[model samples]
Target chain A: MRRGPWLWAAALAVYAFLYLPLAIVVVYSFNDSRLNAEWVGFTLHWYDVLIHDEEMLLAAGNSLFIAFVSAFVATLLGTMAGMAIHRYDLKLLNFMALTPVAMPEILLGVSLLLFFIQVLNLTLGMLSIVLAHITFSIGFVAVIVRARLAGMDDSLFEAARDLGASPWETFRYVTFPLILPAVIAGGLMAFTLSIDDFVITFFTAGVGVQTLPLRIYSMIKIAVTPEVNAVSTLLMLLTLSMIVLASRFAPDVLKGKT
Target chain B: MSGPPFVFLLLFFVAPSVIMVLASFRYPGEFGGLAPLFADTQTLHGLTVETYEFFFSDIIYGYVFLKSIFVALATTLICLLLAYPLALLIARSPKKSRDLMVLLVVLPFASNFLVRVYAWMIILGPQAAFSQAVNGVLALFGMEPVHLLFSPFAVLVGMVYVHLPFMVLPLYTNLEKHDPALLDAAQDLGANVWHRFWRVTFPLSLPGIFSGSALVFIPVLGMFAIPDILGGTGDMLIGNLIKEQFLGTRDWPFGSTLSIMLTVTVLLIVWLTTRLAGRGRHYA
Candidate 1:
C-alpha cells in the first residue's frame, strides 16, 4: 500500500494546531512591548519583574507545598485502595474509586465548597484546597496503582505467603518492590494534577489563598500582561519536563498497563 | 484494607453529593441564599421543590443546558474528525517516530491549559498576528477581515484546540492495538484498500471513537474557562450558569439543582456511550 501525501499533511496540520499557541505565548513573553501584536526588540524584563513579585512567589510556594503534601497522602491512600481492590475483588468499590476523574471540575469544586463552608464549618484556605486536591487526586492514584496491581504476578505473593512470611513481611519483600514505579508514577501524576488544578482549587481556596494557576487567572482576567505570559511560559516548561520525565521513567503508567 | 480511601470518599465525595442533593430540594432564603442545613431548621420547614421547578419552568435555563450539550457535541464531532487521521498516521509510523508523535500530543496537555487558552486569545484577538495575516490575504480580494475574537467562533476554536489532544490520545491507543494481520488477511481475500478499511479497520476503531467522544464531550460540556475566556455575551454553558449561581446570584439552592442535573446528565451520557459502543462492537 502506498502512503498518501494527504495523511502526512493532515498530521502536520494537527500538530501545528496543538503547538502553535504555546509557541506564540513563549515568543510574546519576551516581546518588548505591552501589546503582543507588534514585536519590538526582545527583552527579559517580564522575567525580572516576575522574580521580584512577592505575591506570585508566595502563591507558587503554597501551590508547591499543597501539591507535595496532597500527592503524598493520595499515593498512600490510593495504594491501600488498589491493594484492597486486588485482594477483595469488590467490583462496586473499584467503580466508585475511579469515578472522580469522570466527574466535572465545577461540580466537584462547588460541592466541596458547600460541604466545607456549610456542613463542616471549615474555613476555606490552604487546608481546604489541600483536602479537595486529595479527594480528587486519590481517584487518579488509585487508578494507576490498581492497574499496576492487576498486571502483577500472583505467584510471587503466594510464594512469599507459602514461606510463612507475615502479611507485612510479604508486602515489604514482594509487592512493594514491584509497585514502587507505579507508586512514584501516581505521586507524580497527583503532583501534576494538584499543581495544574484551577477550578476545584478556585472554589475551595477562598479569600487570601492563591496558587499559581489562581494567580495567573486573576492576572489574565484583568489583562493579558507580559508578566502573566512570562509566568505561564515558565510553568509550561516545568510541567512539560515533569511529564516527559514521568513518561520515560514509568512508561507502563502512561499506558494504563500499570 | 480499603478503609482509608472508602472513608475519605464517603466523607468528601459522597457526603458532599448528598448535601448538594438535599440542598437542591430546599427553597432559597429571603436573601436569595441558602442557610446551612444545620444553621436553621426553620428553612427546612419551608423546603420545597421550588429550585427544581425554576429549572424546569425557566426556558432560559433549559436553553443554556441544551446549548451546553450542543457545543459539546459539536466539539466532539470536530475533534473526532481531526483526530482519526492523525491517530491513524501515528499508529502506522515507525517505532521511534510513533513515540515522538505521541509525545507531541501529550506535551500540550501537560502545559497549563489556561495559558494555552490565553495563547488562543492572542492569536484570535483583534489586530493580532492571525487577523493581520488573514487580512493581508483578504485585501487582495477586497474583503474585510472577519472578527474572530470574543465571538462564538473563537469559543469553538478554543474548545476544539484545547480538546484535540484528548480525542487523539485515546484513538491512538486503541488504534495502536489493532492487528495488522486482519488488514493483510482482508487484502489476501481480494479486498481493496477502501473495502478493507471500511469493513475491518474502521469497525475496529469504533471503540476508540466512542471513548474519545466521551472524554472530550464530558469536559467540554462543563467547561467554564474556555467559554468564560473566549466567549461573548451569548455563550453561557452549564458550567458558567453554575458558577453564576454560587458567586454572582448567591442562589445556592438553584445552583445545587443545576449542579445535580449536570452531574446526572454527564453520568447518563457516559453510561449510554459505553452501552452503545459495546453493542456496536458486538455487531461489527
Candidate 2:
C-alpha cells in the first residue's frame, strides 16, 4: 500500500491545531505591546512584571506548598491501598477507593466544601484545598501503584517469607524497595495534578487563599494581560519538567497502553 | 491492611458525597443555602424532592442537559476522527519522532488550563491572525467577514483542541505496539487499504477507541470553562447551570441535584463502555 499526501496533510494540520495556541501564547509573552492582538516589537516587559507581582509569586508559592504536601500524603495512603489490594481480597475496598476518580471534579469539590463547612465545621482555606487535593490524588496514585504491583514478581515476596522472614520484614526488604520507583512516580504525578487543579480548589478555597491556577483564572476573568501569558509560559515549563522527571522513574506509567 | 486507605476514602471521598445527596433533599434555606439536614428529625420535614422536581419539570434544564450531551458526543466524535489519523502517523513514525509526538500531546497539560482557554480567546478574536487570514480570503471572494469568536463554533473548537491529546495518547499507545505484520498479512489476502483497515486496524484499536472516548466525553460533558469563555449565552451547558447554582445563586440543593444527575450519567457511560470493550476483547 502506498502512503498518500492527504494523510500527511491531515496529520500536520492536527499538529498545528495542537501547538499553534501555545506558540501564540509564547510569542505574545515577548511582544512589546500590552495588547495580545498586535506585535510591536520583542521585549521582556511582561516577564519583568510577572516577577515583580507579589500576588502571583505568593500564589505560586502556595501552589507549590500544597502540591508537595498533598502529594506526600496521597503517596502514603495510595501505596498502602495498592499494597492492600495486591495482598488482600477486598473487592468493596478497591471499588470505594477509586470512586473519587470516576466522579466529576466539581462534584468532589462541592462535596468536600459542604462536608468541611457543614459537618466538620472546618475552615475553607489552604487546609481544605490540600485535603481535597489529597483526597482526589490518592485514587490516582493507588491506580498507578496497583499497576506496578500487578507486574511485580510474587516470588520475591514468597522467597523472602520462605527464608524465615517476618511479614513486615519481607515487605520492608523486598516489596517496598521494588515499588519505590512507582511510589515516587505517583507522587510526582500527584504534584502535577494538584498544582494546576482549579475547579476543586475554587470551591474549597476561602477568601484570599489562592493557587496559581485560581489566580490565573481571576486574572483572565478580569483581563488577559501579557503578564498572564508570561506566567502561563513559566507554568508550562515547570509542568513539562515535572512530567519528564516522573516519566524517567516510571516509563510504564507514562506509556500506559494497558 | 486496607483499613487505613479504606477509612480515608470512606471519610473524605464517600461521606462527603453522601452528605451532598442528603443536602440535595433539604429545602433551599435562608440566602439560598440548604436547610440543615442534621439539626433534628423534625428537620427531616424540611427534606423535599422539589430540587429534583425542578430539574425534571423544567424544559430549560432538560434543554441544557441535552445540549451538554450533544456537545460532548460531538467533541468525542470529532476527536476520534481527527486523532485517529494523527495517532496512526505517530505510531508509524520512527521511534524518536514517535516519542516526540507523544511528548507534544502531553505537553499542554502542564500549561495553566485557563491560560490555554484564554489563548483560544486571543486566536479567535477578529484581530487574530487566524481570523484575519480567513477574512482576507473572504474579502477577495466578495464575501462578508464571519464573526466566529464567542460563538458555538469557537466553543466546539476549544473543546476539541483541549481534549485532542486525551484521544491521541491512548490511541498512540495501543497502535504503536500493534504488529504491522498483521496489516501486511491482510494485504496479502487480496485486501485493499480500506479493507485491511476495516478488518484489521480498526478492530484491533477498539480498546483505545473506547478508552479515549471515555476520557474525552466525561470531562467535556461537565466542562464549563470552554463554554464560559468561548461560547455565547446560548451555549450554556449543565456545567454552567451547576456552577451558577453553587456560586451565583448559593443554591446548594439544586447544585447537588445537578451534580448527582451528572455523576449518575457519567457512571452509566463508564459501565456501557466497559461492557462494550469487554465484548470487543472476547471477539479479539
On DockQ, the leading prediction is 1
**Candidate 1 lDDT (Cα, 0 to 1):** 0.86
Candidate 1 residue lDDT tens string, A229-250: 8998999888877786777657
lDDT of 2 by residue, B76-145 (tens): 9999999998888888887777677777777777787777788998898887788999999999999999
TM-score, model 2 to reference: 0.94
Q: In candidate 1 chain A, what residue range of length 10 has the lowest lDDT sum?
A: A249-258
**Tens digits of per-residue lDDT for model 2, A31-133:** 9987789889999999999999999999999999999999999999988888888778567778877777766567888888879987999988889999999
User: In model 2, which runs have C-alpha deviations exceeding 4 angstroms?
Assistant: A1-4, B37-44, B94-97, B140-144, B278-284
Off by over 4 Å in 1: A256-258, B36-44, B136-145
Q: What is the lDDT of residue B98 in candidate 2?
A: 69
TM-scores of chain A, one for each prediction:
0.96, 0.96
DockQ of each: 0.70, 0.63
